[model samples]
Target: MAPTAKPLRLLAHDADDLAVLSAALQDAVAKIGDIRWDAQARTLTMACNRFRWEAAKGKSGERVRSALQFGDVAGVQARNLRRDAKGAVVELLSMGFEPAEEAPAGVVTLTFAGGGDMRVSVDCLDVALADVSEPWTTPRTPGHAD
Candidate 1:
Protein backbone atom coordinates (compact mmCIF):
# COMPACT_ATOMS: atom_id res chain seq x y z
CA MET A 1 0.00 0.00 0.00
CA ALA A 2 1.17 3.49 -0.82
CA PRO A 3 1.90 5.73 2.14
CA THR A 4 0.40 9.15 2.62
CA ALA A 5 3.45 11.08 1.61
CA LYS A 6 4.43 13.86 -0.76
CA PRO A 7 7.20 13.49 -3.29
CA LEU A 8 10.50 15.10 -2.35
CA ARG A 9 11.83 18.15 -4.14
CA LEU A 10 15.18 19.48 -3.10
CA LEU A 11 17.95 21.84 -4.15
CA ALA A 12 21.54 22.07 -3.03
CA HIS A 13 23.18 25.49 -3.18
CA ASP A 14 25.95 24.82 -0.70
CA ALA A 15 27.88 21.98 0.82
CA ASP A 16 25.58 21.70 3.83
CA ASP A 17 22.52 21.57 1.59
CA LEU A 18 24.22 19.01 -0.61
CA ALA A 19 24.92 16.80 2.38
CA VAL A 20 21.21 16.51 3.03
CA LEU A 21 20.51 15.70 -0.60
CA SER A 22 23.34 13.20 -0.64
CA ALA A 23 21.88 11.47 2.35
CA ALA A 24 18.51 11.25 0.62
CA LEU A 25 20.11 9.85 -2.51
CA GLN A 26 22.11 7.26 -0.65
CA ASP A 27 21.56 3.71 -1.91
CA ALA A 28 19.87 4.88 -5.09
CA VAL A 29 20.35 2.49 -8.01
CA ALA A 30 20.41 3.39 -11.66
CA LYS A 31 21.43 2.18 -15.10
CA ILE A 32 24.39 3.71 -16.89
CA GLY A 33 22.14 4.49 -19.84
CA ASP A 34 20.02 6.67 -17.57
CA ILE A 35 22.96 8.86 -16.65
CA ARG A 36 23.72 11.73 -18.96
CA TRP A 37 26.30 14.48 -19.20
CA ASP A 38 25.54 17.35 -21.54
CA ALA A 39 28.74 19.21 -22.27
CA GLN A 40 27.11 22.04 -24.13
CA ALA A 41 24.42 22.44 -21.54
CA ARG A 42 26.87 22.08 -18.69
CA THR A 43 24.79 19.62 -16.77
CA LEU A 44 24.90 16.09 -15.47
CA THR A 45 21.64 14.26 -14.91
CA MET A 46 20.71 10.80 -13.68
CA ALA A 47 17.47 8.90 -13.29
CA CYS A 48 17.50 6.59 -10.33
CA ASN A 49 15.30 4.30 -8.29
CA ARG A 50 15.91 5.71 -4.85
CA PHE A 51 15.32 3.82 -1.63
CA ARG A 52 13.09 6.11 0.40
CA TRP A 53 14.92 6.44 3.65
CA GLU A 54 12.64 9.25 4.76
CA ALA A 55 9.56 7.10 4.30
CA ALA A 56 11.17 4.02 5.77
CA LYS A 57 9.06 3.26 8.81
CA GLY A 58 10.48 0.22 10.52
CA LYS A 59 11.14 -2.63 8.02
CA SER A 60 8.58 -1.35 5.53
CA GLY A 61 10.21 0.71 2.77
CA GLU A 62 9.79 1.86 -0.82
CA ARG A 63 11.73 2.88 -3.91
CA VAL A 64 10.74 5.86 -5.98
CA ARG A 65 11.79 7.13 -9.37
CA SER A 66 13.92 10.22 -8.92
CA ALA A 67 15.80 12.68 -11.09
CA LEU A 68 19.10 14.05 -9.84
CA GLN A 69 20.68 16.90 -11.73
CA PHE A 70 23.69 19.19 -11.47
CA GLY A 71 24.06 22.51 -13.18
CA ASP A 72 27.15 24.55 -14.13
CA VAL A 73 29.14 21.37 -14.41
CA ALA A 74 32.47 22.26 -15.93
CA GLY A 75 33.43 18.64 -16.59
CA VAL A 76 33.01 15.10 -15.35
CA GLN A 77 35.36 12.17 -14.87
CA ALA A 78 34.52 8.59 -14.00
CA ARG A 79 36.45 5.62 -12.69
CA ASN A 80 35.80 1.87 -12.62
CA LEU A 81 32.82 2.11 -14.92
CA ARG A 82 32.01 0.02 -17.99
CA ARG A 83 30.81 2.95 -20.06
CA ASP A 84 30.60 0.70 -23.09
CA ALA A 85 28.07 -1.48 -21.29
CA LYS A 86 24.89 0.53 -21.32
CA GLY A 87 23.02 -2.00 -19.25
CA ALA A 88 25.42 -1.87 -16.34
CA VAL A 89 23.77 -0.78 -13.09
CA VAL A 90 25.34 1.20 -10.28
CA GLU A 91 24.40 1.78 -6.66
CA LEU A 92 25.25 5.20 -5.29
CA LEU A 93 26.81 5.17 -1.86
CA SER A 94 27.48 8.84 -1.13
CA MET A 95 28.28 12.26 -2.51
CA GLY A 96 30.94 14.66 -1.29
CA PHE A 97 32.49 17.95 -2.35
CA GLU A 98 35.97 19.42 -2.36
CA PRO A 99 36.34 23.13 -2.84
CA ALA A 100 38.53 24.35 -5.65
CA GLU A 101 41.12 27.12 -5.43
CA GLU A 102 38.44 29.70 -6.19
CA ALA A 103 35.49 30.30 -3.96
CA PRO A 104 32.18 28.65 -4.90
CA ALA A 105 33.91 26.48 -7.49
CA GLY A 106 34.46 22.92 -6.40
CA VAL A 107 34.61 19.27 -7.39
CA VAL A 108 31.70 17.08 -6.38
CA THR A 109 32.49 13.39 -6.11
CA LEU A 110 29.81 10.72 -6.39
CA THR A 111 31.13 7.53 -4.87
CA PHE A 112 29.52 4.22 -5.66
CA ALA A 113 29.92 0.75 -4.31
CA GLY A 114 33.08 -1.21 -5.18
CA GLY A 115 35.20 1.94 -5.60
CA GLY A 116 33.47 3.23 -8.74
CA ASP A 117 33.00 6.99 -8.65
CA MET A 118 32.39 10.09 -10.71
CA ARG A 119 34.04 13.45 -10.08
CA VAL A 120 32.18 16.49 -11.31
CA SER A 121 33.96 19.81 -11.54
CA VAL A 122 31.46 22.56 -11.11
CA ASP A 123 31.50 26.33 -11.52
CA CYS A 124 29.48 26.41 -8.33
CA LEU A 125 27.28 24.22 -6.17
CA ASP A 126 24.06 23.76 -8.12
CA VAL A 127 22.07 20.62 -7.73
CA ALA A 128 18.49 19.37 -7.59
CA LEU A 129 16.80 16.09 -6.66
CA ALA A 130 13.13 15.44 -7.22
CA ASP A 131 10.91 12.41 -7.00
CA VAL A 132 8.96 12.00 -10.23
CA SER A 133 6.68 9.03 -9.64
CA GLU A 134 4.75 7.23 -6.97
CA PRO A 135 6.80 4.94 -4.79
CA TRP A 136 6.41 1.18 -4.76
CA THR A 137 7.18 -1.11 -1.84
CA THR A 138 10.56 -2.76 -1.71
CA PRO A 139 11.16 -6.30 -0.57
CA ARG A 140 13.63 -5.18 2.07
CA THR A 141 15.30 -2.13 3.51
CA PRO A 142 19.00 -1.69 2.78
CA GLY A 143 21.54 -2.82 5.31
CA HIS A 144 25.26 -2.21 5.77
CA ALA A 145 27.86 -4.20 7.67
CA ASP A 146 29.99 -2.43 10.19
Candidate 2:
Protein backbone atom coordinates (compact mmCIF):
# COMPACT_ATOMS: atom_id res chain seq x y z
CA MET A 1 0.00 0.00 0.00
CA ALA A 2 1.18 3.56 -0.62
CA PRO A 3 2.04 5.67 2.39
CA THR A 4 -0.28 8.43 3.46
CA ALA A 5 0.69 11.75 1.88
CA LYS A 6 0.23 15.34 3.04
CA PRO A 7 -1.38 18.15 1.08
CA LEU A 8 0.16 21.43 -0.09
CA ARG A 9 -0.04 24.68 1.85
CA LEU A 10 0.55 27.29 -0.80
CA LEU A 11 0.84 30.99 0.23
CA ALA A 12 1.83 34.20 -1.51
CA HIS A 13 1.78 38.03 -1.23
CA ASP A 14 -0.08 38.48 -4.48
CA ALA A 15 -0.61 37.19 -7.99
CA ASP A 16 2.81 38.29 -9.22
CA ASP A 17 4.78 37.12 -6.20
CA LEU A 18 6.23 33.63 -6.23
CA ALA A 19 4.81 30.73 -4.27
CA VAL A 20 6.92 29.56 -1.34
CA LEU A 21 7.67 25.88 -0.76
CA SER A 22 8.78 23.35 -3.35
CA ALA A 23 6.62 20.59 -4.76
CA ALA A 24 7.79 18.94 -1.60
CA LEU A 25 6.83 22.09 0.23
CA GLN A 26 3.46 21.78 -1.32
CA ASP A 27 3.21 18.08 -0.60
CA ALA A 28 4.20 18.61 3.01
CA VAL A 29 1.41 21.11 3.53
CA ALA A 30 -1.98 19.62 4.25
CA LYS A 31 -3.66 22.32 2.25
CA ILE A 32 -3.14 25.86 0.92
CA GLY A 33 -6.48 26.85 2.47
CA ASP A 34 -7.68 30.45 2.06
CA ILE A 35 -6.01 33.82 1.82
CA ARG A 36 -7.41 37.34 1.92
CA TRP A 37 -5.50 40.53 1.18
CA ASP A 38 -6.40 44.19 1.68
CA ALA A 39 -3.83 46.30 -0.14
CA GLN A 40 -5.52 49.60 0.82
CA ALA A 41 -5.84 48.70 4.48
CA ARG A 42 -2.50 46.88 4.45
CA THR A 43 -4.10 43.96 6.26
CA LEU A 44 -4.22 40.23 5.60
CA THR A 45 -6.42 37.36 6.72
CA MET A 46 -5.51 33.70 6.38
CA ALA A 47 -6.75 30.36 7.66
CA CYS A 48 -3.64 28.58 8.88
CA ASN A 49 -4.53 26.95 12.15
CA ARG A 50 -5.00 23.53 10.66
CA PHE A 51 -1.38 22.55 10.02
CA ARG A 52 0.22 20.35 12.65
CA TRP A 53 3.49 18.49 13.30
CA GLU A 54 4.40 15.32 15.11
CA ALA A 55 5.71 15.53 18.66
CA ALA A 56 9.49 15.58 18.89
CA LYS A 57 12.25 15.84 21.46
CA GLY A 58 13.22 19.34 22.56
CA LYS A 59 16.56 20.43 24.00
CA SER A 60 15.51 18.83 27.29
CA GLY A 61 14.36 15.66 25.48
CA GLU A 62 10.81 16.50 26.45
CA ARG A 63 8.01 16.13 23.94
CA VAL A 64 7.31 19.40 22.15
CA ARG A 65 5.14 20.54 19.30
CA SER A 66 3.51 23.79 18.31
CA ALA A 67 0.35 24.58 16.38
CA LEU A 68 2.14 27.18 14.34
CA GLN A 69 0.45 29.77 12.18
CA PHE A 70 1.43 29.14 8.55
CA GLY A 71 -0.05 31.83 6.34
CA ASP A 72 -0.32 35.61 5.75
CA VAL A 73 -1.21 38.33 3.21
CA ALA A 74 0.50 41.68 2.51
CA GLY A 75 0.52 44.60 0.09
CA VAL A 76 3.00 45.74 -2.54
CA GLN A 77 4.43 49.25 -2.43
CA ALA A 78 2.57 50.75 -5.36
CA ARG A 79 4.84 53.75 -5.46
CA ASN A 80 8.34 52.28 -5.59
CA LEU A 81 7.39 48.88 -7.01
CA ARG A 82 6.36 47.94 -10.49
CA ARG A 83 4.04 44.94 -10.79
CA ASP A 84 6.12 42.58 -12.86
CA ALA A 85 6.10 38.78 -12.95
CA LYS A 86 9.63 38.61 -14.31
CA GLY A 87 11.09 38.62 -10.77
CA ALA A 88 13.18 41.80 -10.68
CA VAL A 89 14.16 44.07 -7.82
CA VAL A 90 11.59 46.71 -6.88
CA GLU A 91 11.44 49.37 -4.20
CA LEU A 92 9.70 48.29 -1.05
CA LEU A 93 8.55 51.11 1.23
CA SER A 94 10.49 51.42 4.46
CA MET A 95 8.73 54.48 5.89
CA GLY A 96 6.32 52.70 8.27
CA PHE A 97 8.78 49.80 8.69
CA GLU A 98 12.15 51.31 9.56
CA PRO A 99 14.87 53.84 8.78
CA ALA A 100 16.07 51.89 5.75
CA GLU A 101 16.17 53.38 2.27
CA GLU A 102 13.84 51.00 0.39
CA ALA A 103 12.78 47.35 -0.04
CA PRO A 104 14.04 45.23 -2.93
CA ALA A 105 11.74 44.36 -5.75
CA GLY A 106 9.62 41.17 -6.32
CA VAL A 107 8.44 41.13 -2.74
CA VAL A 108 5.20 42.12 -1.06
CA THR A 109 3.84 39.74 1.57
CA LEU A 110 5.77 37.04 3.42
CA THR A 111 4.76 33.90 5.33
CA PHE A 112 7.24 32.33 7.69
CA ALA A 113 7.08 28.98 9.57
CA GLY A 114 10.65 28.68 10.79
CA GLY A 115 10.87 31.30 13.56
CA GLY A 116 9.61 30.47 17.04
CA ASP A 117 6.13 31.32 18.28
CA MET A 118 4.97 34.63 16.88
CA ARG A 119 5.75 37.22 19.52
CA VAL A 120 5.65 41.01 19.50
CA SER A 121 9.29 42.00 19.87
CA VAL A 122 9.71 45.42 18.33
CA ASP A 123 13.41 44.64 17.75
CA CYS A 124 13.36 40.98 16.73
CA LEU A 125 10.00 39.69 15.56
CA ASP A 126 9.28 42.77 13.48
CA VAL A 127 12.43 42.44 11.37
CA ALA A 128 11.86 39.00 9.85
CA LEU A 129 10.34 39.62 6.46
CA ALA A 130 11.85 38.67 3.08
CA ASP A 131 11.83 39.46 -0.63
CA VAL A 132 9.93 36.64 -2.37
CA SER A 133 10.42 35.79 -6.03
CA GLU A 134 7.70 34.67 -8.40
CA PRO A 135 6.70 31.08 -7.58
CA TRP A 136 8.83 31.80 -4.51
CA THR A 137 11.82 29.82 -5.77
CA THR A 138 13.99 32.07 -3.62
CA PRO A 139 13.43 34.11 -0.48
CA ARG A 140 15.50 37.21 0.37
CA THR A 141 15.05 37.50 4.10
CA PRO A 142 14.01 41.07 4.81
CA GLY A 143 15.33 43.03 7.76
CA HIS A 144 11.97 43.23 9.50
CA ALA A 145 8.27 43.00 9.34
CA ASP A 146 6.64 46.22 8.22
Candidate 3:
Protein backbone atom coordinates (compact mmCIF):
# COMPACT_ATOMS: atom_id res chain seq x y z
CA MET A 1 0.00 0.00 0.00
CA ALA A 2 1.10 3.58 -0.60
CA PRO A 3 2.39 5.48 2.42
CA THR A 4 -0.18 7.69 4.01
CA ALA A 5 0.56 11.35 4.42
CA LYS A 6 0.97 12.50 8.00
CA PRO A 7 -1.65 14.88 9.24
CA LEU A 8 -0.50 18.49 8.97
CA ARG A 9 -1.22 21.27 11.41
CA LEU A 10 0.50 24.63 10.98
CA LEU A 11 0.22 27.88 12.88
CA ALA A 12 1.02 31.37 11.59
CA HIS A 13 1.84 33.85 14.30
CA ASP A 14 3.45 36.63 12.27
CA ALA A 15 4.01 37.95 8.77
CA ASP A 16 6.80 35.48 7.96
CA ASP A 17 4.77 32.57 9.14
CA LEU A 18 1.84 33.84 7.14
CA ALA A 19 4.04 34.06 4.06
CA VAL A 20 5.11 30.47 4.46
CA LEU A 21 1.53 29.42 4.98
CA SER A 22 0.50 31.38 1.92
CA ALA A 23 3.12 29.67 -0.20
CA ALA A 24 2.01 26.30 1.03
CA LEU A 25 -1.54 27.17 0.14
CA GLN A 26 -0.71 28.42 -3.35
CA ASP A 27 -2.92 26.90 -6.04
CA ALA A 28 -5.34 25.65 -3.41
CA VAL A 29 -8.87 25.22 -4.68
CA ALA A 30 -11.82 26.42 -2.63
CA LYS A 31 -15.54 26.60 -3.23
CA ILE A 32 -17.13 28.23 -0.20
CA GLY A 33 -17.36 25.11 1.91
CA ASP A 34 -17.41 26.47 5.47
CA ILE A 35 -16.16 29.97 4.98
CA ARG A 36 -17.52 32.16 7.72
CA TRP A 37 -16.69 34.79 10.28
CA ASP A 38 -17.73 34.81 13.92
CA ALA A 39 -18.05 38.34 15.21
CA GLN A 40 -18.10 37.32 18.87
CA ALA A 41 -15.22 34.89 18.46
CA ARG A 42 -13.31 37.19 16.12
CA THR A 43 -12.32 34.32 13.90
CA LEU A 44 -12.56 33.41 10.23
CA THR A 45 -12.67 29.80 9.16
CA MET A 46 -12.40 28.34 5.64
CA ALA A 47 -12.37 24.74 4.51
CA CYS A 48 -10.77 23.92 1.15
CA ASN A 49 -8.60 21.55 -0.78
CA ARG A 50 -5.01 22.72 -0.22
CA PHE A 51 -2.31 21.33 -2.47
CA ARG A 52 0.76 20.21 -0.58
CA TRP A 53 4.29 19.29 -1.57
CA GLU A 54 5.25 15.64 -1.30
CA ALA A 55 8.78 14.36 -1.44
CA ALA A 56 7.89 11.42 -3.58
CA LYS A 57 5.01 12.76 -5.65
CA GLY A 58 5.59 16.49 -5.78
CA LYS A 59 2.34 18.45 -5.37
CA SER A 60 -0.40 16.15 -4.11
CA GLY A 61 -4.14 16.52 -3.79
CA GLU A 62 -4.87 17.15 -0.13
CA ARG A 63 -7.93 18.53 1.55
CA VAL A 64 -7.38 21.03 4.34
CA ARG A 65 -9.61 22.88 6.72
CA SER A 66 -7.97 26.13 7.72
CA ALA A 67 -8.82 29.00 10.03
CA LEU A 68 -7.59 32.48 10.84
CA GLN A 69 -8.36 34.01 14.21
CA PHE A 70 -7.94 37.71 14.65
CA GLY A 71 -8.33 38.61 18.32
CA ASP A 72 -9.40 42.17 17.53
CA VAL A 73 -11.27 41.83 14.33
CA ALA A 74 -13.15 44.95 13.41
CA GLY A 75 -14.85 43.88 10.19
CA VAL A 76 -14.67 41.64 7.14
CA GLN A 77 -15.04 42.14 3.41
CA ALA A 78 -15.09 39.92 0.35
CA ARG A 79 -15.39 40.15 -3.43
CA ASN A 80 -17.20 37.50 -5.43
CA LEU A 81 -17.81 35.40 -2.36
CA ARG A 82 -20.50 33.07 -3.58
CA ARG A 83 -21.84 29.57 -3.19
CA ASP A 84 -21.82 29.23 -6.97
CA ALA A 85 -18.07 29.76 -6.94
CA LYS A 86 -17.95 25.99 -6.57
CA GLY A 87 -18.18 25.58 -10.33
CA ALA A 88 -15.12 27.74 -11.06
CA VAL A 89 -12.45 26.12 -8.91
CA VAL A 90 -10.97 29.24 -7.32
CA GLU A 91 -7.22 28.94 -7.06
CA LEU A 92 -5.37 30.87 -4.39
CA LEU A 93 -2.70 33.00 -6.05
CA SER A 94 -1.22 34.86 -3.10
CA MET A 95 -1.87 36.30 0.35
CA GLY A 96 -0.87 39.52 2.06
CA PHE A 97 -1.58 41.62 5.13
CA GLU A 98 -1.57 45.39 5.33
CA PRO A 99 -1.10 47.24 8.61
CA ALA A 100 -3.61 49.84 9.62
CA GLU A 101 -2.62 53.44 10.10
CA GLU A 102 -5.47 54.72 12.25
CA ALA A 103 -6.51 51.53 13.99
CA PRO A 104 -4.65 48.64 15.56
CA ALA A 105 -6.29 46.16 13.20
CA GLY A 106 -4.97 45.22 9.77
CA VAL A 107 -6.21 43.49 6.64
CA VAL A 108 -5.31 40.08 5.36
CA THR A 109 -6.14 39.62 1.72
CA LEU A 110 -6.30 36.30 -0.10
CA THR A 111 -6.10 36.79 -3.87
CA PHE A 112 -7.36 34.12 -6.20
CA ALA A 113 -6.13 33.49 -9.70
CA GLY A 114 -9.56 33.89 -11.25
CA GLY A 115 -10.21 37.44 -9.97
CA GLY A 116 -11.97 36.51 -6.72
CA ASP A 117 -10.63 37.64 -3.36
CA MET A 118 -11.37 37.47 0.35
CA ARG A 119 -10.09 40.08 2.76
CA VAL A 120 -10.00 39.70 6.50
CA SER A 121 -9.74 42.81 8.60
CA VAL A 122 -8.13 41.98 11.92
CA ASP A 123 -6.24 43.38 14.87
CA CYS A 124 -3.56 40.72 14.73
CA LEU A 125 -2.46 37.80 12.63
CA ASP A 126 -3.26 34.33 13.91
CA VAL A 127 -3.86 31.51 11.48
CA ALA A 128 -3.77 27.74 11.22
CA LEU A 129 -3.88 25.14 8.44
CA ALA A 130 -4.53 21.44 8.78
CA ASP A 131 -5.14 18.46 6.55
CA VAL A 132 -8.69 17.11 6.84
CA SER A 133 -8.58 14.19 4.38
CA GLU A 134 -6.36 11.49 3.06
CA PRO A 135 -4.03 12.70 0.28
CA TRP A 136 -4.22 11.20 -3.16
CA THR A 137 -1.81 11.15 -6.09
CA THR A 138 -2.03 13.88 -8.72
CA PRO A 139 -0.70 14.06 -12.26
CA ARG A 140 1.04 17.41 -11.75
CA THR A 141 4.78 17.21 -11.35
CA PRO A 142 7.17 19.89 -10.22
CA GLY A 143 9.21 21.50 -12.99
CA HIS A 144 12.99 21.80 -12.83
CA ALA A 145 14.89 24.90 -13.87
CA ASP A 146 17.95 23.03 -14.95
Which candidate leads the pack in TM-score? 1
Question: TM-score of every model?
Answer: 0.96, 0.23, 0.76
The C-alpha RMSD in Å for every predicted model, in order, reads: 1.3, 15.2, 3.9
| Per-residue alpha-carbon lDDT of candidate 2 for residues 1-146, written as tens digits (9 for 90 to 100) | 11322233343332222222211111121122233335554443333222112211232211111112223223322222223432432221111212113332223233233321111112111111121211211122223345
Model 2 Cα displacement at 128 (Å)? 10
Pairs that collide, model 3: none
lDDT of each: 0.94, 0.24, 0.68
Q: For candidate 1, what is the TM-score? A: 0.96
Native-vs-model 1 lDDT?
0.94
Q: lDDT by residue for model 1 over 10-124, one digit each (tens)?
A: 9998999999999999999999999999999999999999999988978779999999999999999999987888899999999999999998999999999888999999999
Worst 10 residues of 2 by lDDT: 116-125
Number of clashing residue pairs in every model?
0, 13, 0
Of 1 and 2, the candidate ahead on lDDT is: 1
lDDT of 3 by residue, 1-94 (tens): 2366576677876778888878777776666655667888877777766666543353444344444344456677879767555455566777
Model 3 regions more than 4 Å off: 1-4, 54-72, 83-88, 102-104, 141-146
The deviation in Å at residue 141 for candidate 2 is 28
